[model samples]
Target: MKLQVNIQILQLSFLALLFFTPLLHKTISSAPFAAVLHLLSANLRLSLSCTICTFISIFYYFYTRPSQVYMLNYTCYKPPPHRKCSYQVAENFVSRNAQFTEKTLDFMRNIYLKSGLGDETYGPAFIFEEDGVPTLNYAMQEAEEGIFSSIDALLLKTLIDPQSIDIVIVTSGSFSPTPSLSSLILNHYILKPDVKTYNLSGMGCSSGVISMDFAAEILRSSRKIQNVLVVVTESITLNWYSGDNRPMLVTNCIFRVGCAAALITNDPSHRRVAKMELVDSLRTHDGADDGAYRAAFQEEDEKGINGISLTKDLIRVAGMSLRKHIKILAPRVLPLSQIVHYAYSVVSAKFWGDESKPIVPDFKTAFEHICIHTGGRAVIENVARVLKLDDEVIEPARMTLNRFGNTSSSLVFYELAYFEAKKRAKMGDRMWMLAFGTGFKVGSLVWKWLQNSSQEFDNPWNDCIQNYPLKT
Candidate 1:
């Protein structure tokens, strides 16, 4: 409506200019010199006032415009050696469990063998102890270790003080304890009394990217320069399922302990030290559709034990969600050449028969590096197949999954760590981070690397990175 009003006003102004210009010319030519001079002086004064007002408005708009968000640094927590779960250790725990029947044990074992996880992935304290239980205390302990360690390292790396943080955002896929994770961070760090906080739960694996997007929005809209500490982690101790439901057993084989923390700031002074600048971000939710909503759901099995089921329709739901998401995102990030090619393909396909499929846009053309979510072997392969990504392009994701397992929302950060370990990303490089969650939601973060990638002391892959890009 505002645009329409502006157009109508422009039209009226044009018509008035046409109607009055000839009369004004005639008046100047025929009227007395003094009268014409007075009229011209009045017109000049009006025009000058309008020009001054326009300049003032433009100045105000620029002064009050939103600030650009930047990522100062990030760290991914590495569990202690004692907490590492080898294949033998995992098998022993499952075999010794009374809850698992021989059939269920066999099913879980098969899933583990194909889970694309390495022998050194870490589990929660409960899984490492002989008689340890998946109690609430252990869950909190797991959260504390992952969250605090990553945040500590991130603060140290960025040289950011706790009291200076203005916003705190924490996200956990399936864990939400009473003193919410955000509150826990506040108390643990003794952050500023007025620090804003948000605890996000039930957002699934994509929550990391979602939280980053959330932080970017906050920084952009804030009145004053602010710093946001985004903590992305998952407490898998309590979520460890003992039920025998086949559909729900995948989590047991894939999920593991992981956490990541990043410090994002809108302070222009830190731009020189920032790793990446928030370029463009997009999020799409297809949960309104029944299949997408039920793709991965938590429910009780026949025996009344609760577990989250990974339905057979999950792969399809992910593909569908990606299709819908990129429709909106492709235009924003893709170069004009690529967008035009894609548009032509799409428009041409509609004119042709249904047999002629619309050509998929080459996302590689837009992003120099992509951090695909390492949800599982199948999920990674599926994303690669859909995007036609090269093996080298997805090596970071594949390696991170092998090393860390599915750390839920934190997986993408681990992949970013992998990129740094290999020194693959350079200054001015465009990076894309993509992840899918339980709500069948897909989230994307487009980042421009402000500095060349450098492996930090806390990089999760620093020790084992040399052996990465392993055999499939």
Candidate 2:
């Protein structure tokens, strides 16, 4: 009996050991899972803490954030004097009298005649008379003073607080030192010494767009930037070359005293009165060639004759530069709809084996308005032909050139203002601005109108439009 009892106990012990052996092995093998459970518990505590911290951060952001000032509205300041000038009859003065070579004069006359200049449909307007005379420094100074007064008047009329302007950008092509135009404006406007200021000199007709691009960059970087004031003008009085060079003589006839000030704000809240919002800008330079630079440079030859000569190749250079500009910009501002149309044209041209076939992208579908630089009549006509724009679409540019006579960098703005005065621009209208300069540079800016723009009764084109004798 003692042996049997011992045997039973031993059997039971063996069975108990057998049952616990598997559980022990599982626990040992899954030590990582046990550790994971501990880690999960710790992470849960951390997650709860993080949630509380996030809630507190959000609360702080809402309660203590700084008040933001959004641009509520903006307008181009047109002082009464400028308004009067716009309405007044422009004087026909021949400041110089160097006779153009008969051949050159005839060539110019033919170009002028071929241009829509004689079309009565555009009506009688101001035409600058070229005299073979040199422009003087005093004349430029006088022009500058007039511009300063005009800017002051416009600023006052616009009712923008002088103190609120954070930056000032001034551009001119003439010798702009010894009293930089920017200093003159700061003093006139009583801007604070701390205000950010920049004076751009030597950039010819393209300076206006260049200045705009620079301002946009500054605005994008600093949230504190509220208002940017851009002043564009040319001093034809100073750079008048008295030489017999036909190119220099051309300036004697074409350029006039003109100044324009534009106020731009990045604050989205001020979209109402703002005529247009800048969309895209492009600049291209072909500085690799000396010929491109010489195409528009001033030369001081013997006989004290100093003036810039126009090269016959300038038009070709401008065309090349513009082609380069379009290549880079077409991808950005061209709407997907326009892009699709262009793509279809490309594919069609490729399959048809007609590489010479031109694919004129439908710009009308993309832009409601176009403002090509008013460099000259021929330049305008060339661009119009390339773009396949109607004469009426280019009317504003032509009229601006007829009246203002290529006011340099500010020409585009003048054209834009003309459109506004005509009441032609409706809300949601898109405008494209193209300009070329001495750097053999071509640049463009795209804008969309925010509201209805109407022509002012006192606009320069008012009388001309009424008498415009042309029909489509």
Candidate 3:
């Protein structure tokens, strides 16, 4: 706000000086007659008035500069006790309890084995018994526990009073309780009664980045709204599929339990300790196209069992969406030399009819670290290929997938945890996080590290960072 005021003052001062320049010149160049003396005095008075006004404006702006937005810190939820479902255990449980026939079970087993998931991945709700009743109780428990635990920890770590949080935004793609997730948070935390709240549902995996984008805009818009608590999670309990639909079964193999809580504030004082500063963000949706819209859709099976369908066309649609998104983002982050080279490649290919593909700009030049969504092994592979990322550049996403098995909306946070656990992020380093979702949406968040972050004890990967960059 103060920055805007300063610019306006500078503009007005320049215009005033221009208008007075001619009068001052006339006073100096003209003969010192009676009329000339009066005119000179008048010009002097106007000049003094303009100078005083400009000084006052400058002083006011300096004294009243508004706070800058900062991402104070964030915490990703680790699976609760007894929730860590190993691959073999998950497979055995599925074999014994799933409603699908033997052939369909074999298909799911094959997908799981080759899904790039490690033994440590987690699931909040699994029905090990044959006649288990599907319940929202477990889903609610996961949401409540995931949200409260992580948020409580973040507030404690940051020493931020819950009552001071001005806004609460919760994004849970699969489950939204009746009181609303935001309301539940407010009630549980006993936050200020007038705290602004919002709940976003059905936004899919990209919703984590989307929620951050939303918070950034909100902080940019209002100085009074200092702090926002954003919770990104997915409910896996109710989403479990019992049907044999191949598309639906794909979700069962990948989606898992996870949640992340972040405190974003416009309080400039927190900048010193903040993990990263949001540099820029971009979002693109290809849902307008039929193929993209249906790439990942929720539908009932032949027997009317509801489940999310991960269609074969998902990867192609993701590539296309990301292509469009990065076209807009590249100019903002890429170095001028890389941008120029990329532009030259495009022009040469267009005019010279060069059959070779136009160059993909070196994103490594823009970001020191990258976190691609761990939607699945295929999603990570496609993003890496599309961006021409190296093996090391793509390790966080791959390893996060191996360890967490696509925690849906919270997956990127887990990948980010990997970077922190490995101590790879340095001060001033730029990081890029990209995610794809069922809206066939793609979201990118660029962050500049504020400090050289050390590994936090609560980081999900704390116990296993040394074993990562696994030989796949």
Candidate 3: global Cα-lDDT? 0.86
**Per-residue alpha-carbon lDDT of candidate 3 for residues 1-472, written as tens digits (9 for 90 to 100):** 4458778777766776676666666656675674656555655757775786677667756555544568899998987657777877777777777477998888988998889998888877545445555588877887888898899879878999998999999998778889998988998889998899989888899999999999998987675748999999888888888898998998888887899999999877789989889988889988889999999998898999999999989889999999999999999999999999999999989999988888999999999999998988888899889999988898889899989898889889999989999999999999999988888899999999999977886888878889988875
Candidate 2 Cα deviation (angstroms), residue 228: 0.9
Error of 1 at 40 (Å): 11
Q: Output the lDDT of residue 321, model 1.
A: 90
Off by over 4 Å in 3: 1-14, 19-67, 128-131
What residue runs in model 1 are displaced by over 4 Å at the alpha carbon? 1-54, 57-60
Per-prediction TM-score: 0.90, 0.73, 0.90
User: Higher-TM-score candidate among 2 and 3?
Assistant: 3
Q: Give the Cα-based TM-score of candidate 1 against the true structure.
A: 0.90
Tens digits of per-residue lDDT, candidate 1, 316-407, equal 88988988888899989988998898888887878765457777889999999999989998899989988889898888888888999999
lDDT of each: 0.88, 0.64, 0.86
* Better model by lDDT: candidate 1 vs candidate 3: 1
Predicted candidate 2 versus true structure: per-residue lDDT over 186-275, tens digit per residue: 887799788888998878898888888777777755656478888887776566544555566666445555667777787666666666
